[model samples]
Target: MSLDDKPDNTAKPHDRLAEALASDMAAVDALIAERMASENAPRIPEVTAHLVGAGGKRLRPMLTVAAARLCGYEGSLHHNLAAAVEFIHTATLLHDDVVDESKQRRGRPTANLLWDNKSSVLVGDYLFARSFQLMTDTDNLRVLSILSNASAVITEGEVLQLSAAEDLNTTEDTYYKVVRGKTAALFSAATEAGAVLAGAPEDQIAALHDYGESLGIAFQVVDDLLDYLSDAETMGKNVGDDFRERKLTLPLIKALAKADADARAFWTRTIDKGDQREGDLEHAMELLHATGALEETRAAALEWADRGRERLKVLPESELRQMLDDLADYVVARLR
Candidate 1:
């Protein structure tokens, strides 16, 4: 079944997703707290906690725990690994806010907002170090390799995005390459580490990695879509933020793919150079609608989610495994 097949909670269907997550995420909390407590510098602890406690879906660590359960893991190392995954995810968000000059996250003031940029940068480094230490403590070379390589790819992806911004020449291939590196890399690493920790068979491990990678790409695609379709109150950020920042995301990329001469002039003047003005956003939206680019972007996310669910078929039937599939769907269902 597809991840989109999740039970609708309020209408005629009841979902037991929370019950499945509760089975494993309680220990994940302690692990996260323990990892966050080691900021030896007094300022370090407070600042990191602000970002750490900002609250997210905890999807990466959840992937670790879910993969472990699907693989029949019964040991406690999943706890430490889960924390490691969380630390990495939080560190990225901390650094991302700084890079994006973002003042808010998860509907609250960002660490970079509450504290100075320097504090956010240093605390992010601290979290990175702590993640490395925790992963090393597990003494699993494969796990370390997976996370470390993903880190490298994530940095490369960020750099790629930096370079791609405002470049109207960016293609769908380039967009996928960037997202795969920035987002999918981490998801793959988390699930692969979970399976490796559990001693899952090689094929199953590969399948889990594919599952996470697909889910991650699908999740990011939907996020990019929401920027155009939702309000800041619901999306937890400003609409047209990407356009303001001159960041070329999937919708923009698709719109660019079909830009006519006049539309091209509009984009090159406003979007590429960040020379936004009255009616610029609306005009851009018109181009995207006319070209059907928004629909195409959403379709791409749906295709990735379908691939993710298909990969899950490699795993045996179980509630936890089924929940993972549903969670994948939930990530992209926002687009629909």
Candidate 2:
């Protein structure tokens, strides 16, 4: 099923939080639309609107707004920061689609596939520049520092992932580094910047940062797991797309680590050499199951989710905190 197929009225943790913060989110939506506009270049807004209009969870920006609210931020500047966070995320998606040669996002055609790669890449750059302009409006140096560092780390992570792709020697430690860079960096920044803007105490700021980091790691682990187990309709892309792309995600990496002679040869032929046959994906899934890699990966995701929940305890107890706690559980719930 597509994201739209998910039941709207269901009491998902994110839905509950969004409902609670409805007014603030509406402000954020307005700010995003206003900021994404361009006078001279119609193509910029057109490309951005296509991706932004495709319904997303808007989880990162929500984290920013929620963190600010949790820390008693009463001003409207968080809305600007939240919109900036979203622009950064959407910009990354546009760049990633071109890099991955992706055909679909959110069950719709990717910006790169629908337009040209040049348009996607240039538009992504424009969004990145726009995001910086928005963040500067906050006039908080710390917030700017956190976001700039995250942008740099994300680019570094993508480059590292490019080097590690299909390399069988990629260890779990290396995998964590990549995840922390590419995915967790923005998550931690979103929360940390909000707290900084709120003038939160150092301990509270640290707690929110840790919470976002752990949650982001768990989120990516579950995504990697789903790419193997979920169907195209549910995942918004074909199952085993990672395998076809020669990405050495957790399950496949674990399976390869334990592969005997025959298994190693199979991985080498399909992943390293990219000489996939008809039943290669099925056989790869069988190996993941037989080697207990899938279970192991699930366990890791659960551990990270628990880590995120524990970090939330440092914040004051409130309904928002509970929602954040539930969000951590919901991230890995798909594995069950």
> What's the TM-score of each model vs. the native?
0.93, 0.96
Among these predictions, the greatest lDDT belongs to: 2
Candidate 1, residues 272-293: lDDT per residue as tens digits? 7778899998888889889999
Candidate 2's C-alpha lDDT? 0.92
Model 1: per-residue Cα lDDT at residue 274: 71
**Tens digits of per-residue lDDT for model 2, 224-262:** 999999997787678998999999899988998899999
Q: What would you estimate as the lDDT of candidate 1?
A: 0.84
Give lDDT per model, in order. Answer: 0.84, 0.92
The number of the candidate with the highest TM-score is: 2
Off by over 4 Å in 1: 1-18
Query: How accurate locally is residue 204 in candidate 2, as Cα lDDT from 0 to 100?
Result: 96
Collision pairs in model 2: 1-234
